[model samples]
Target: MAKPQKRYVCQACGSVATRWQGQCADCGEWNTLVEEAGATVTPFQAKHNLQGGGRTFQLVGLDAEIALPERMGSGIAELDRALGGGFVEGSATLIGGDPGIGKSTLLLQAAARMALAGASVAYVSGEEAADQVRLRARRLGLGNAPVQLAAATSTRDILTTLGQGTPPALLVIDSIQTMHSDLIEGAPGTVSQVRASAQELIRFAKERGTAVVLVGHVTKDGSIAGPRVLEHMVDTVLSFEGERSHQYRILRAIKNRFGGTDEIGVFAMETSGLSEVANPSALFLTHRDEGMTGATVFPALEGTRPVLVEVQALVVRLASGATPRRAVVGWDSGRLAMILAVLEARCGLSFSTCEVYLNIAGGYRVQDPAADLAVASALVSALAERAVPADAIVFGEIALSGEVRPVAHAALRLKEAAKLGFARALAPVATAGEGGMTIDSFKTLGSLTDHLLMR
Candidate 1:
């Protein structure tokens, strides 16, 4: 018999090492490495396994007939939208978010709604007691929902209880980090433990045709707290994002094997619980004063939905020899630097001696490159003390050479903007706006700057 080797795994990132180190080399977290026990490797085992003793399985052709996976609607339209229509039977979904950001509330709401709609739903919480969950459900006006609830941290006990009965249509694990598996030697939340617990639950789902929804805890950086493989093991990954202070929450699909990625469902935290926001643009857009200098509205597209958001900028001239600070919120800082460079080099606008602040209103983050034109418009409007027309929306990409570039779904963006009562658009040249809105097209950054200055 050969002695088993001691393996160390990083708790922050699932990297393995032969020995412990002060800091993890992969994720650079200090004191995160812990030892785990594994089976010993024997020299003769490698030589003996050249051929397999497994039973043969049939292989199917690419043209084989198949049926689309059936879906189970959660009875909540917003949750179903984030889930790409509805939850498919036997699928595993992982949802992660910051603490106290309404993860439990949303899941409880879904579970209650599904139960009320006559689906067999089981909600197991490792983080809360059954009575606590019941109290919350009652507070959410779901006191009469017939959903089955339990408080268990042991993976074996939870699986065994569910195995004895007819499998439920849905099973919700309140959080994966708190789940413990006796098959794994490490404690819960460890790399080995999370991987093992999730694997077992996913296997149960597959064998029993139960749609499993696992709530995950996010790290300080907002990524799910577990082995990265946990995300890959699931059929869908949903990110719940919102500030605790804000009333709005966004459920964004990061990966969906069955549907389109980047699809988002919007909800607002209300006294009654999480209510669907039918018009997401209303949450992100504030009442703009007429002749406001530093604000421009940009139509942002997420998956197939178009939402309008406000881009705000403020520029202040600095005294001589003072360091000018650049600040940005809800948008990329590097892109801001690039836009400033383009404004100075290609458009002859000087910002080297001025402090600049840029913000996306409503704490809504913008990742669309099309917002480049909008940000530039707001910056120019701020610097020149001129207001971008309140009724006009701006969206386009800016090239390094200062040319304004057209973005995708220009027609779709215009349609949404027109429906919101916008009367005009400042877009790239050749963008077709056939929606009865006036289009003021620009070719270059200099021309856009000239348009703002002249106005």
Candidate 2:
């Protein structure tokens, strides 16, 4: 009788080995070693496809294929811009966000737009029935776009349908978590199944010239919940981020093979559907009651687009020994901490006994250091309970030495501020020479201290 073959398997990473150990060196998981039948792909085996001889990695790029035509327009100007002009053929895109965060809504809009552009589109959803999707489509006011919908959960069935139908201009998978494959032995969302399903779909996208968008689920940490490979496998990855309580949603590109990764798309969820906020700054500041203390308008850039945003801050003295709390809703917490440290060390400002809360109005995340001036201004306003000028605009990076440091694209930021009817802008002194528009230059945080105190 043939002897049963045995091999060591690392449960953490699925790497196979002949020797066993207390820990899996392949994946660094402690005591994840178990003996099983050998299960691993040799480097030679992986270089080719499963069916036998296919294009090897080394065989590719012998002579790069001529670049394809320019991106196909998505019809929504803002989304087109966010996608760096449009969809690249055969690119796999993963869009992830919180539940009820407009993931399906956005894709439905895109599918209809593509269909209106005279391109065929197929939308697959496992969670929603076709009738429900069609009902939402009617609500979007999509005028006679020849878009098709399918309620499918099986990856194979979707692939088969795609193969049988006319090649679609785009394919929309409502989500990846719901997809299951018969080739994998695990549950739908298990690491193995997700990986296998994603790989198969990725292959399908690349083999066909369809722009496929996969909606994904986000974990509590705000990361897409799946094997890390799910992220690496896609050509582009975007996240739909916002508070569900608010109507505004921000689509940010985390990965883009054909475009800049820093691109962001702003939209508003209205009674109709997701509508692009063309002048997002105006929308972000529309609800302002005017002359409010602890409020600031800040000029910033997202990818190549410039925007002005309202920043609000609140500071209050603590009644107990809980220590000063600093929290930000739409900006980086680490960034706020860094600014606070700068304030304490450079300007000798002590809010150790106070509570500080910062918010970027409109549920938008601000990445521009230009907001430094706004944050500082807001901090002062909150502490003193004084209102910042309604027309005041602020942007600058603060150094530990209290110096206002220069930032990139001063011209763009200034142009945006000027276009927005902003009266005065406090920016870094160094970049004051770059932008043609008028702006106040401040070098030190201490210099602005009196201005805050006086206000």
Candidate 3:
């Protein structure tokens, strides 16, 4: 039988090696190579000829008229919004998160809502038994939802059962890592196994016109576990993220062929299940009676949604010859260092002898570059021991040359801040005033520094 040729594969990059090695040559990752059996091919198949045998398919023009795929909501407004209105028929979505981060709970809740809304939904759990899922449903108050449930891990059996009768409108596989395909020569979650299993499931989803949601386990670095191609095979990639200590969970779309990326859906984990947070800005902002040093409000934009969050900082003088510490949470550490350097070089403010601490309120992470101005404001306020205006918000991009740059969606940010009762804004010079709020525009970091120190 040709004794099935053997080869080594890198789990990190899916690269093949002729022999096992301690480090992967392609990805440079250590101890990721594992041996696997290579498929034996006949002489004729090894020739790599593409001549004649496959069915011919017609190629259509880009402008050809075709009906758009229908979208069905899961009765969850936040989820629908993050999914670019709703889940498209025949689409495949991959969602990944840390363990205990509520990936299964969110999917089960969505499935229940869809079933209650009259959509045929089937949930297959490879990690848990059917009764365990049922118990969870009961806990979530969805015991009466008409969603079909099963506990299976064999891909062939799942396809066989799903192929019978009418195909369900929505299908959820509670983790793709646990699914095994008979055709694959390795255990489930292996590089080849994951690739092959996902391929079959995605093909079924497209052929059956069912929206399939696949749960994925994440690695220590917070990326989906499996070959990188698994993410590319799906129509959308969602990331469920939150700190275990925090009650808020963020559902972010990292890749979406049918929708905009970077869109986020906010949810609060309660005893009943996940509840949507329509006004996430309010939840992220900590209400305080008075403004304090090192605290600044920043209007951050998440996709099309504007969120107002507090930027807090602390600066303490370090002992002589002691290494200054720079700690940051919910904001980029490198960016904070760059901002501090700019403050010293451009604004003549020295932080070389100070230990700095920065944090974003409510365990929320900020990625927007417009947060530069706010973070700088907080740092300056901390060093100067002066509180920024209690009702004022700050946002803008700070360049290395200390130039205050304008950011996108300025109007949306201003309106949201105004709606949140922020009476004044310290922003870039180009930002337009809105919502009857007073504007304090700055043209450079030096000007902002002067305002903070001089005030």
Candidate 4:
């Protein structure tokens, strides 16, 4: 006969507090704490834990032989590539992205395709009405698909209905944030509610051997909203990323228990639906003008695929007594600052009096450290009013001491570049020339700057 205790949880970081507070002590965010009811445990219940009530599982040896898990393809090559082949039975997947990033569209397309391929698919939308989703499906030319669609937010109703029938091969929940669980006290998007709802759905997925796909909303900083444990509860985590003004979207695999992580699937959003891009390099790399200054081609490797993108830089000298401005797009500003510092201190380049602007062409974001060489080449070319070779690609890492460092998959990058009609490479000295392409290797960043200046 104990009273239920009240607890406050931080919606930002899932930290629990005894009482309401203005700021979350763990995440330093203000106005995110919300109250929730904690379970009541009597004194007898707390001390009556016995070890004999649980069923034990058999321990298996590491050398035990087993068959590979069966996969169900969504009939999309790029998506299959990112998923490390296809969706596995009894696996739970969580995909998150910013608003209007085509997450629901992509999932709808997959569900339609799977339904057409004779797989039992169910799509439950919590944010949109059934008629609205149907209208979109018709617009996407999937009106004939036999996909079971519903628009309900109650987790209990969804589970109860699905439990009465044969379990579907695939179940897609459009947006976990809008799902409400009656067992939890708070609203849908609260930390406790999201965690409890996801746990229930994942349990259903495991017990019924259904592959579940859960859509998630993202915070302002682009991380998945709700509890961080939500990501860990799923068997796989995918990120859908794209700019609103851009036509291309990338599906990146952040975590996978059945496959390799960091794999990416490229797609372009069109009027009809999302179409897979087999050659993503073509979308990110713009046409190279004959003598375009401040531009360099870079080979970026994502998982097993190689993509070529262009790096562009601009430098304008500012008048004395005026503060110089630094601007960047589609790349990290902190990394750009580091590169500028290295060029000024170790390579004898002076950019203090100039305003610098850096951009990655075609709205593609570059995260590879190998882009350092390409970025430096672009900056040096811009400041000196010179142009890098139109057919040459650049990739390598630069240290603070100015030494050019070799990168992973050098031969793979060269091979990809060669396939794209590039004949020369400006890379680290340790990188060997492959596939009959010439390599202008530099040992240090100082040497690279000298070469660019003298060219």
Candidate 5:
């Protein structure tokens, strides 16, 4: 018998190497390579011919008519929205989040709702036992749902049992890291084991026309803990994001084969269970008796939804000989620095002798460029110790040259702001207004700076 070949594989990126190396050449991660035994191949197997040994199938053209995959609702509107309407049959989805971030709770609630809707659903837990799941269900008041529960880690056993009966319409794997495959040699959570286990489960889902939802753990850097290919192999990738100190959770789809990317679903975690937040804007806006310096209201767009959030900034004069400090939360520090540079260079503002702090209210993150004008307004207001108009909202992209640029969905954002009782908006020059709200348009940052400072 030929000796089994040995190889090294990077646990982080799944790059294989013939010899052991300290660093992975593919991803540049150090000390992640582990030695593993490769499959043995005989001389006869190596010389086997494949020219005429297998069956052939006809290929169809792009115009071939095919039925669209059916979608099954989980009875949770927020979850369904995040999943692009609903879960598609024969699809595999991977959800990643930090521990205690309600990944299991959300899924359990969804599974129970689906079961209540008269669909057969099975939930397999690799981290928790069936009794623990039952207790959790009781706590969430979903103990009476007809959802099947099992606590198993062996992929072979799970597949064997599912193969014997009618395939469930939905199958949820509590976590993919703890699952082990008998065909693979490595232990559970290893790169090979994770890849192989996910492959088998995905294959079963496609062949049996069942929807599979796989729970994944995130690394300290907030990325899914597995090979990069693990993300590519799934049909949909959803990220559960929220600050542990906050009660709101955001379900965002980063990649989807059957739906549009960047779509978000909002949920509020409560004692009963995760409740859907129909109006997310109201959750992020704080009612203030009076407008204060360094505070500006910004209408931000999260995917297709327009949300109103407050942007705050503080500028404190540093003592002589002290280095100025800059800190930011819920926004990019680099972008903040860039905006500061523009203020100093284009608007003739002095910030080098002061410490600046920026924050987005309600612990919500803002990625839209339309926030640039609002952020700049807050910073300048802080520096001048003057408050922006309490009933006015600001939104527009600021170019490096200090010009205010137009953003998409201007009408949608203004409508959302108007519905929240804002009487005026400071936006790009071309933005149109509705609902009798006063529109103040600025072509350049200098005009906005002059208006705020000269007031």
Candidate 6:
């Protein structure tokens, strides 16, 4: 008899390997390899599923069948817009967040809205009892009586029950971490179990044409828990993020095949439910106190929305021998070090003696390189002991040559800034702003040194 196939997989990025190694060659993490029974399905398998022997030379440019009745409303207007107007039939959405970050609440709201919109919705809670979900639903003040809730952790029984239901219904599994399958012997949240469970869920959703919303948990490292393959298998992936002390939550898409990924939806938690924030720009603005150094506004774009957020910096004499500790909450730590190096070398600033710390308030994080200009300004302002002009917003990236590089959507950033009543903006020469404000362009940090240093 032929021997059964065996291979190893990386737990972080899901790259397969035939040999067991101490470190992953893909993601470069240590001890992440696990033995698997069979080889992973390649993208070629997907192509073969459609190609059928690769002999077709038929007509091209075929239009997609846009079905009207299959569309379902998510009840939240901004959320619906982020989903390309509404949920498409047979699409899968993976909602992820940290504990107590309102992942369950958001889905409960969605299920209630779908049922009220005339679509039969079934919400299966693997993490909570049916009574617990009912209590939370009542706390959210949901009065939509059409929705049904079931408590089940077994994936096989859950899929069987879904088969008995009528077609054209929405199914929600809250969440994937607590879900289990008899096919996998390990615990539910293990790397192997998660991969297997997610595969089954995806297959069920695809064959049944049921829109599946899977709630996912995030690891302590702040990434979605489970194999990375789970993310690539979904049709859309969203993050529900916010500071627990604050009542606001932001729903942002990290990946979407059907719609623009940059779109974001903001919500204000209330006694009733999640209320949409009509103006997110105003939410980030603070009540100004005079002469606060190291605080500057940088117009940043999230999806298409332009938000002017305050970039804060603190540079103080080091109290410990750890070499000027670097701490950042929402921005990249490596980028912070790069910006500091630019200040020390190109800008001729003295940062060796001081410890630098950067933070994005309200637990908000940004990955846009456009934040570079704001970070530079914040550091310079703190070093010079003068605040940046409150009316002026910053934009651009700091290069090793100290040049200011342009970022995309500069016009939108300035347009929102103008509507918010900002007057002067220090933007890169690469981007000239729209009307109603003066957009000054800079070539390098050396050119803007006088303005930032003297305030």
Q: Which TM-score value belongs to model 3?
A: 0.88
lDDT of 2 by residue, 333-416 (tens): 888887887788877787888889999877777877767777988888777777776666778888777888888887788778
Per-residue accuracy of model 3 over 335-432 as CA lDDT, tens digit each: 99999999999999999999999999999999999999999999999999988989999999999999999989989999999998999999999678
Summing lDDT over every window of 10 consecutive residues in candidate 5, give the lowest-scoring window.
Answer: 284-293
Whole-structure CA lDDT of model 4: 0.94
Model 6 alpha-carbon drift over 4 Å, by segment: 1-70, 183-187, 317-323
For model 1, residues 67-175, the per-residue Cα lDDT tens digits are 9999999888988988899999999999999999888999889999999999999999999999999999999999999999999999999999999969999999989
Question: What TM-score does prediction 6 earn?
Answer: 0.81
Of the two candidates 1 and 6, the one with more favorable TM-score, higher being better, is 1
Clashing pairs in 4: none
Listed in order, each prediction's TM-score against the native is 0.89, 0.81, 0.88, 0.88, 0.87, 0.81
Per-candidate local distance difference test: 0.94, 0.82, 0.94, 0.94, 0.93, 0.83
lDDT of 5 at 371: 94
Q: Which stretches of candidate 4 lie over 4 Å from their true place?
A: 1-54
Candidate 2 — what's its lDDT? 0.82
| Candidate 1 vs. true structure, TM-score | 0.89
Number of colliding residue pairs in each model = 0, 2, 0, 0, 0, 1
lDDT of 1 at 366: 97
Per-residue accuracy of model 6 over 237-259 as CA lDDT, tens digit each:
98888888888888888888788
RMSD vs true structure, all candidates? 12.5, 10.2, 12.2, 12.4, 12.0, 12.7
Displacement of the residue 32 alpha carbon in candidate 2, Å: 48
